[model samples]
Target: MASVHPRVPESGIMSRPRPRHLAPVALLIVSALTLVGCGSDDESSEPPVASATEAEQETPGPDDEPTEPEDDTSLADFLRSAKVDDALVNRLGEVGDANGYGLGEGVETSLEERQQLATVQVGTCRDVAVGHRTWEGIQASDVSSGGTEEQAAAMADFLREEFCPHVAPYKEAPLPKQSLGGPEEDAKGGRGLASPVSWWDTRYRRVSWSEECAAQTGQPIGDPVAYRLSDDAVVCATVPPAEQLKKHLISVDVVFAEPVGEERAQDAALSLLPIDAVAEDETEGTNPDWSYLEGGCLNLNIQSQDLEDVVAGLKENAEPWAHAVHYSDGATADGAVGPYTGEVKQVSLSTGRNEPTDSGDLTC
Candidate 1:
């Protein structure tokens, strides 16, 4: 679905990505055999979704001859080269059960198999013909249905768990220690971005992404940093690292469409900072009503190497960001990612918060 949430972080707090992608999470309160569902009632309009079930009856397979043009011309060569024989499908089951996720015998299959199985299994299901299309730069899953999202998530999770050590494309032997956090948070402690602030620090966090995400992002694929794809929508921070605070780098998630290259993406990322525009308010007493925005991470090590430029980019971008209204907080900002977009939103621009260090370095 086309997201009403801006593809990129709009300038301000109120303008962050909306959390529309997240499935409604209801807290099931179970007491003495009585189950009371407790959560925001706003999601009451959503349909009672069903999970993807194993194919009860397989439909006659598609013709060997091509029916329509390949769904994704980009994937033609890969599909042709990659074997999807009965052996591979069976392997999926073996891997699934071995991993203990209970994918069982038929739940695990390739994108092609999922489409074919859907034809007969779910009457209303539409085949996600082989193709590649990213939503806001994330790889969109080939399967899209009530339980498809859950299935895709589970598959990605188990595949990474079992195969990442040897098969993951992004795993490097001497992988750099990394931490996710904001500019303010130190590598030692304090909450800044998320974690893994260092490239090769021992305290870094281990990250993983799904094969669907790897295929869709079309980046340095087969890596842990690959942007995670979603069947329905996306959440920030949960996928790849957006803009890294270490060496400054941006991803399509932040800049929107094709960034062209590192230079262009860097420039665009810097634009979002709005440092110059907010100079007058940069003083200690300055307190512009600030909020947060978010972007996606490409997981690429490429960078501009100019840390100042990166901070400036954050400052510049936040100035004009379209702010979203916070019904609970009674606050607003330039823009936001979505309701479930997660953290890594906009960094604080308040004078004290964005103040420079003794060496004149940006704090966050």
Candidate 2:
């Protein structure tokens, strides 16, 4: 046999050994190609496992919907979050252990009505904050009552910040001063400023004749006849049909002025009455001068149509005096001696003077 070389495969001569580093890389490429070729076309197939970092970094797909956030900004929610007292919360229309605050149509008040209540509450708080009115005065107001001083302050801040931002201006703007009496004072006296004098009228409501007429009587009576009962009281009567010429007493109010003490006010009111006027009734053990009028003041229920003529005559006689006379309808009759434009010192239905009684005496 001719020299036989080790049988070498014909392919072995053309192929060279891959480097060790490249061998692993070549194996990976081949494995990937094998996976791609063997993979199913269906999208339902399991996806490839992601690395820890890649998994977290994955974005939401088309069908991945986001959830809506819960609403935590409502008034009720705000009250709860603020940790307000249950009693105070009840006043704000929030459901609480206490009764409703009598705002709007009870607890189920409309949005508009609630807003109105908030406005009023905020305004009152502003008054208290500005020192124009006290927290004690809140109870005296017909609109805003029943809230405590602390509650009033808190609710004012809450409403201004969360509820009624439009009323924020009231925080800076000071309101006109009101003659508000404290609860203790109101309890001692009837209303308004507490006074010792019997003739001092404190129960007077600041209402116009028309407003009083509409309030007292169901219907709105036009151009009702008014009479000056005394400096403090004006009796507004409804003018019925011609057949019923007798006017009905609808409302009684005081000709308001700066409050003086009870004794001086009583004396002033007593001095304003017509000299010829007779006592409607008498209370025993009272001063004889005060006995002329009932309740230490003129009768508010006086139903005399002739009182207009009497008032006119008294006004004519008073023209020569130095002071100005304040009438019920807010008209002032100037006297000859002085055009006295000061606040009416006093007014009472029980008192009047046809002639000047005493120039130094203050007019009720």
On residues 238-289, what C-alpha lDDT tens digit does candidate 2 reach at each position?
2221111212211222333343443443334333332222233211111122
Candidates in order, TM-scores: namely 0.22, 0.25
Cα deviation in Å at residue 245, candidate 1? 24
Give the number of colliding residue pairs in candidate 2.
14
lDDT of each: 0.25, 0.28
Root-mean-square deviation (CA) per prediction: 21.7, 40.4
Off by over 4 Å in 1: 1-90, 93-162, 165-276, 279-364
Angstrom error at residue 96, model 2: 11
lDDT of 2 at 130: 44
